[model samples]
Target: MLSFVNTTYLGFENIARKSVYTSLSKDLALKADEQNLTTLAKNAKFSKDEESSFKNTIHFTDFVSNTKISLKISDENLSNLKAKFAGNISLQEDGSYILKKEAESIASGWFADIAYKRGYLKADANNDGKLSDEERKNIYSYYGNGGFYSTSGGNVATVMATEAYSYLRAEEDFRDFTSKSLEEEFNKTLEKDSDFNGEILYGEMMSKGQMIAQAQSYIQNEGYTPPTFLEDMMDQFDQLNKKMLKDLKKLLEEKRLEQEALEKAKKELEKTAEIDIKHSNDQSLDKNLEKIENLKSQNPESQSFKQSLNLKEFSQAYMQSFKVDLKKELILETLKKQNDINYPLDMSKTKIDLKI
Candidate 1:
């Protein structure tokens, strides 16, 4: 029984250890996920002025920027020329293409330009200093007649078309060179095989045909990816929402401070207004005292039994003896026109020797 109990206890211990380990692993994984989300949030946040080009039209790859795309054509395309007509390629019955001429000219232009390495080398057609008139005519005849001095137009076309086939590789002369580039990136692996002297060719590629090629190469015809993750979209949205709440709180705090400042200013203005009012009231009191002094100067003791009192004390004494208005001028006017007042004979005046 003790052995049985020991075995049961060991089993429970193993289960508890496994459970603990399982819980720890889950907790660790969850913590890692949360931490990763935080990092992603930080990186995902864009600046206010950082404009999004998501899905905005942008050129991903340009052929002029990456020209040869691999080429042996220093061509063959020109050798088939009939001189004056820089014509477009034509399609044939055998699913083939050839260059066609627009017009004919006297000289085999290719002989002067392309029969050899073309930088400074030439057949000395016209610029021969030692040649006389007759020799010059002979040189023009030999080069211009287009016999053994030159190749036929179709042969040049075939070589050029073959070269094109080598690179373009499509029968109708094209494969899709554009894609939704911003979704990923242009396949840069293809650029590893390209060969073009971009720096030197910039000034040289000024032809109208080159302009057309450039327009085709750099265009706004692709899709792009916006700032959103399909998988972690919900988490990102939640984080953004939380950020908005934080911003709202910040705005609330700012407005609260502004309101408090306005209230403080209003209180200060009220205090200033109260002080101005008090000063105005004090000025009015001084003016009234001045008026009283003027009245005293105007009135003199003429009667032998005339009574006299200070203005302040007279005002107090008159108030105690009567239930009259507060204006001193009105009380004095009433006293001056005593005939206008008809009162009881016993209550005519106070015993302070005729309170006026």
Candidate 2:
């Protein structure tokens, strides 16, 4: 019986046992079966219990590392994290350690404790209003001072209020700085086809052609040119008319000179021709009279001689008179044609004398 009991003890020890007390003790891990102790023992050889324990260990390390809980953070690392949240460092209420301001506020933490007790910091023995130092340290570790202590001679609320005001002022100044730029205003103005304030500049009010026509009409209607004193009033329109008038005057003056040259040439030609014709006629009359005198000497009582002299002499005189009239008519006709051809522009304004 003793040998059999020993072998049974060895077999039972090789298998695992299940217990209700062990199942109740563990809430997270899978427990041994309450109804089937033999099945539990048989499955123990192929169970994941040891592998699960290792997996849990790794999970715990990963969670702690990721959360920075139980793991001490360097100040530089903490500052980098704080910067990501635009956070600042501050002391905790208990003065035990620093806290991140992004985490808590005055409405929470010791204030809650103080208010619950009676709004007095002296009621707490541990200084942080919490019952224990570790709790106070944990609260401080999480909620930092944020410079909000009364005993330290600084008011956290006032500091916070002032910082807020400062931030607002900085924001206002920054906006003003950006809005005061003239470049944007200039670009906007350049983009518009017209002027701002809905007012048109002198140039914008009228077109170039319209303005010129207006000035010309005004000058013509008023029968007046711009005075030197008021020449500054010359705009785009006035300038165009001024140039046109100046050119027209120059051309008219040139034409007048040409007309005078033509007149002089015609007069000279007529005068020379008249002189030649008169000289030729006078010589012919003199030669015919001499011939008549010789004929009279040859026949004193010849009726034919007397009649020829009277008729020939009278015809010569009449021909000379006719030639003089024709020459005068030709000169007059030439002058009339030149005057008609070289008429000045705007004749009503100024007369250009073409007569030489």
Candidate 3:
């Protein structure tokens, strides 16, 4: 229960913070026009939501703070982008280390061009094909003086891919379409699955950006976002697990009651097996010695067992052998009690004349 509360708290906290970042970003985005924002989009990088957050927090902050604005893509370019960078990609299990190694190789040449364009390499006097320690210091100092450039280095290509991938991965596949159109597109994309129709019965539709914002908002983790497709699978899995867990708990509780009933019945009848292993010190009489043992193990200090009365006095002397347990005894006592269960024994305590 505490865990659930913590998780819920964290989720809402994220929404609040994203409301900060997003609300702030909107004001920041308004400072630039659409054309410039679109151009910034070319160079801007968001560590794909699927990327490991170990280092991406820094990347995300940079993208959010320095990238200046967000822009909506034109439908024509969006189509061409969909053709090139399909939304169906998944992360490699090893955080794509192999792919990163190759990507770094490709990105190795990006800094010189990027730095040159931003005038850092152009300030390279005595041109030794690289920035000296003194030159590097000058570059850092000039960062606030309109020498806008990223220190993203080799991650540029992957960040670009991440942006493209996230852009096209809508809330649901063809989710923006009307319900009638969604049904058509879903059926068209259908392979062999019978239940693959586009009608999701559970949740309202939200786009990739909304999901990312939600993930950032509601999820307590920094720089984590679940894509639309993953959320679809997760929602189904959670529902199934929840139902299965509830059913299993109910079955367990029923089984527990049955076991408790059996124990009490066996104790009432003195039919339980002896502690054959306590051969030298087996001192129990008719096994009623431990009649309260099972209940004691569950609650050793319970007041129910505070009154010690010999079962032999009650069961062996006055009652005939029957399948009834303590529960049945209580019921019959309720039916026959003048005041209560044999509080002070008399002829009135005899419940049935069982000559039958």
- Highest TM-score model number: 2
lDDT of 2 by residue, 1-356 (tens): 00111111111111111110110111221123322322222222211333221111000011101111111223443344344433434434542233343322211221222212111222223342122332222121110001110111221111110000011111212322111111121122222212112221223323434333333343334422323323344355598999999999999999999999977987686567556655654565555556656777888678876675576765664443333335544654565586564312121342222110
**TM-score for predicted model 1 compared with the true structure:** 0.22
Residue-by-residue lDDT tens digits, candidate 3, 1-356: 00112121122222222211001222333334445433443453322334322221111111222332211222332233234334422234643212122222112112211222222333344443334444443331111000011112221111000111111112232223211211122122221111322222101233334543343332233232323434565579999999999999999999999999966865444322212212212232324435545545656666654443246643542332222345534444543453332422243433433120
Off by over 4 Å in 1: 1-230, 301-356
Give the lowest summed-lDDT range of ten residues in model 2. 158-167
TM-score of each: 0.22, 0.24, 0.19
What global local distance difference test value does model 1 have?
A: 0.28
- Please tell me which predicted candidate would have the highest lDDT against the true structure: 2
Better of 1 and 3 by lDDT: 3
Give stretches of model 2 more than 4 Å off: 1-235, 306-356
What lDDT tens digits, residue by residue, belong to model 1 across residues 176-215?
Answer: 2211111111111112112211111211213334432322
Quote the positional error of residue 164 for candidate 1 in Å.
50
Quote the lDDT for 240 in model 2: 90
Q: Flag regions of model 3 displaced more than 4 Å.
A: 1-227, 271-356
Candidate 3 residue 171 C-alpha distance from true site, Å: 28
